[model samples]
Target: MTASRFLDVIVGVVRQHLPAGVSTRDLDGFMDRNRGLMESHIQRQLGGLLARLPGPGSASAEDPELPELWTAAKRTAANLAAMVVAAKLGAERRNPTAQERATLRGYSGWGGLSIEGAASKFPEGFPVPEARGLIHEYYTPSKVAAEIARAVRDLLPTLTGEEGVIHALEPSAGIGRMLSAFSGLGFEDLIWHAAEWSELSGRMLRALYPKLDLYQGPFERWIRERGPNWTGRLHLIVSNPPYGARGAAVAEDPDREYREKRAYAYFLRRALDLLAPSGLGVFLIPSGFLTARTGEMLTLREKVLRRHHLAAAFRLPSVKPGGREALFPGAMLVTDLLFFRARGGELPEVDTADRGILEGSYYREFPRHILGRELGQDAGDDDQTKKPRWGYQVEGEFSRLPRLVERPICAECRITPLLKELDPKLARNLRMGVMRTSLDLDGDALAPISPAPPRSGSAWTATWRSCRPARPRSPPSSGASCTRRCAPG
Candidate 1:
């Protein structure tokens, strides 16, 4: 069925049975992780039942809406059973593929694989349901893409391969702005792999990179399936993931933090997980990932710090005057041009998830939130033993400092995180698709390839107004590079 039709059916089901809250903003779709999404769908439906009832401030159990809302919930649950049975009967009429079966298991489990030893590839072309209704998808304009690509150009040749081919993946390829940046640079032998949730975007990417491996579905499912095989095989991974969207919850990860349902979190975690040793990743994401301490985000910091090489994370202007970020709808978000690499061995930490201490500049948080209660507390030091807070207040400071801001408040940023550290030394390699034999020539014997020189098209300059609210703002100039952040207090 067409994606719109599927959505229509979903909407119909929500309106018919769970009419109290028909919107599926909290609904989950099929994954490439489609099945996990199905459970989310059911969960959202259940939530709607509560929505129909009288909320806070309403009189008690005798509320008139309770009966109708309760009935809607019951009908919804019963209708779901009937739909499952009808779907099963319909499936028996024609032969269904294994992927189809896995999708049905959505009411059951979540699972896929394109790994060499795996059974099959991820279910292709499945419409990824709305992970979280909060996802506001915006395309990266070419001007912005160019700026980002220039920064990534330098991080390339550091990850050289024998055949000179680079394997890169754009987990959320929308009209291929990132792909264009990839080819625009000096590289030609890129092994393009991309996934998109919508078929319309998928078709566009297919036209752009016809021969490249293009998978259709939610990226969470596609990448997880093939992740085992391609893990550490992709030299560079680039993406502007959907911000604030929910993803399938991973329940059994050892770190406990890996269970985040935030779509960007899922994408970033996987992006870091899939990079080959020293392979780079360029991401345009919300600034919050670095500073967020709630739930899994803190441990996610540990993962990013320990598992990946510390690279530059430049704050982008969210609302620069005359800048593209300012012109675009929903543009006033603190954004960042984040860079990192896959570290092979033990990597070091930039900061900690420590609480109360609040010493770490990047990741610390206050012991108690400033809920603005009438409690007589001050942001200043304890009156009994006052001391300077080093500009980091011991109270009321929260995690996710401005979430990372964009510059010019409005400039477009085109970037490329071109990386593929195809180490033949690693037991398994990408090009060879197997364990490397002794006969294979290590890249060391091959002449070294340098990063492509920066291409000059538009002036590569950007400026953001001084963040100091009361300070007089400086007029931005052409070719102005203002990366003044994290200065010592």
Candidate 2:
């Protein structure tokens, strides 16, 4: 049977078991009686369908959509089973109140389906089995993983040279989310290495790409064992390393004293050590790496910034999952794809300069703005001043500040987060603030001036006051200065 036909049959069976005018209370009884048969039947049907499909090598190029559909079906079936179980248990124990049940139902509406379904699909091998029973959890969403992979593709051409095979490594492969991106980038001949700690995930990875070299072990241990061989071997390293900071035991040895450390930092240091000259690395580290205060990070900055140039930083849109509230509460935290070229070689320094202005289409909210402007007829007058400014040059010390502006109002529109919260509709218009002036001065030195008087003879109103001189602040003596001013018109 085709996969589609199997799905239809499963859905049909579920519909038959669903009681008419079924109250939420009846779902548990219905599910308890049918869960086992449904799971067994679906699994058998799916297994048969999969058997008919081509095995990895013999399979004609499988449609990308096929895997997605398979994953979705698996998730849905698993979730339905979990919901039934939870409902049955809730009624049997008489532990949850009606209000609690209602709240659970609401939560189920968004989170329950995915959570239960994910558990069902990978019942034995979740990324972190120790924390499976915890109420809060973390996992990279498929879409976000795909976006990171897309960024890797964007960074590839810059990393590959005219010589040998491209060597890429993903430290925390996590079911090959970023590695899967390689398929889209047309990188079939490259040498790809991934280290995943979870045996289940490793098995999944092997099944997904049977030909690739995958290691099932703690990344740190794998590094210690393979570090020498990888030194100067990797041309590209990308990862969305785990964000846990608690002093937990390393995956390889439970007896070792595993001090508290950011996984990304360890991965960064390892990747740097492994990178070939003129190589590039793209990391999805926590935003805290950019703004946090710690001795380790300071040392890391000194080591990395002094050696490798930072190419670009792209902040992703905040999503509700991944303990985003507790870990990243800065409204939006900036996650970057740091690009670097190894030090001391004939290779030209990596171009860390922002190309948005030269391109004439760079905007922080470029995706939303471009879509709005392109699709809407009432985009109104083009506000050239609000164009995005290149903040920092790749050659300079890595710091949080703007460097160049192609348009006037760019600063106000791009930097101010409040505008979006206050009047989102106005935010869409792209014309609320005064157009900013193009000043050659650094961001910190520029003073904010009120709009010029409508006429020279007009009284100095609050709206047309003199420019406010920026206060002198203590600079990070070791790091680049963080001072930035609103551009003067």
Candidate 3:
């Protein structure tokens, strides 16, 4: 039977056998009556899908079970069961509690129907469910965790201080994966602080690490209310911040102030704000921060580079089309890791290169045991020279920062030597003298275009108040220098 059909059958059984006004609390009778019917079909579908999937090492483009497909199957069954229970709970006009919602949503379970390994002692473990919308909240895979741990190791030298303990914060601490990683690295006398949005996950994280000062709330509010007290005191910040648009719970005020709508950007801003003089932050966030082409993004980028010293950034592999499933599914956004120190004296030099542990010939060089446990394969020594690996192009103090103001192409740009043409008068006028004056348009200062000859036809097409230039051309010999500026009047 189809997966949806199977779910329908299970839901049908629950609806029919469920007694009138029966609360989800007392579903023992309902579960017992339909246990076989539900588990039979669910297990059959999940098991078949799992069996057909190839092992991780296989490069053959044969029928590979995509991670989304597996996630869909599990989510279908889990959501169907939850809907039925929700119906039962609502039959008595009662809303399910947060704990019930978590259970119903398959959060408190055996890590989303584990097919690779047998259920461990703790069934309700840290397997992040398929992401909900743009909120890409997947659990950090063990391989990625190891990679971050390696970055932390490199960062240890910078953490030298006379203090007896280092203060670290893991905002959005999902089930203590990062915390566990730090502990494994043997960080001595570390004072841990954790913040979580989910009450269920918060409770579980607190239980797991009783020493942590766990704060349960939206990170924005937590940062704002608790920020003043923490200024220049926090030592390190490490997290895989949630990626998505502003959440429903976040008030519009914070977003308006930042003028950026992404949740991760806000987390980054707060992280940089709450750092000690020599503090460090490591985040595995979306690739948009580097590649975004909006004014807001560019402004934020300028702010970050000016304020902080970016130590290293590694560009990890993202899910490609028609490829095997990556560790994070439903996370359509590309991922990268950012290691930067809080703003201090003169932006410290960066080491952005394609030579980190996750980059070049050294990426797949982990211990055989780690590879076996994490990637389900014995490590190979294949040449990775031709292979793509994750690494960052370190930005110098003024390197790679784009000009926010759109300067006219013919004015104040280095590409003037390339555009070989005859009109000496126009070239001299466009140089610096004539185009120096700024014309105010709508209270904003805009420079007038260089009255140069148009490529398409004679005489530039002029409007009442302004004129638009034809699309600029880049010579292939000059390394593809396309003009993003249009002279505004």
150-257, model 3: which lDDT tens digit per residue? 336434545543475677888878756677656532355467788888654665454444557989877777766765455455678898877666676566335354
Clashes of 3: 0
Looking at candidate 1, what is the lDDT of residue 433? 24
- List candidate 1 segments past 4 Å from native: 1-135, 248-257, 293-296, 322-328, 346-489
CA RMSD for every model?
A: 21.4, 24.4, 24.4
Mark the 10 consecutive residues where model 1 has the least summed lDDT: 456-465
The Cα RMSD in angstroms, rounded to one decimal, for candidate 3 relative to the true structure is 24.4
- Residue 196 accuracy (lDDT) in model 1: 83
Error of 2 at 328 (Å): 11
Question: Considering every candidate listed, which one attains the maximal lDDT?
Answer: 3
In model 3, pairs of residues that clash are none
C-alpha local distance difference test of each model: 0.43, 0.41, 0.46
Candidate 3: misplaced stretches above 4 Å?
1-135, 160-162, 252-259, 320-322, 330-332, 345-489
Give the clash count for model 2: 14
Q: What TM-score would every model get versus the actual structure?
A: 0.45, 0.44, 0.46
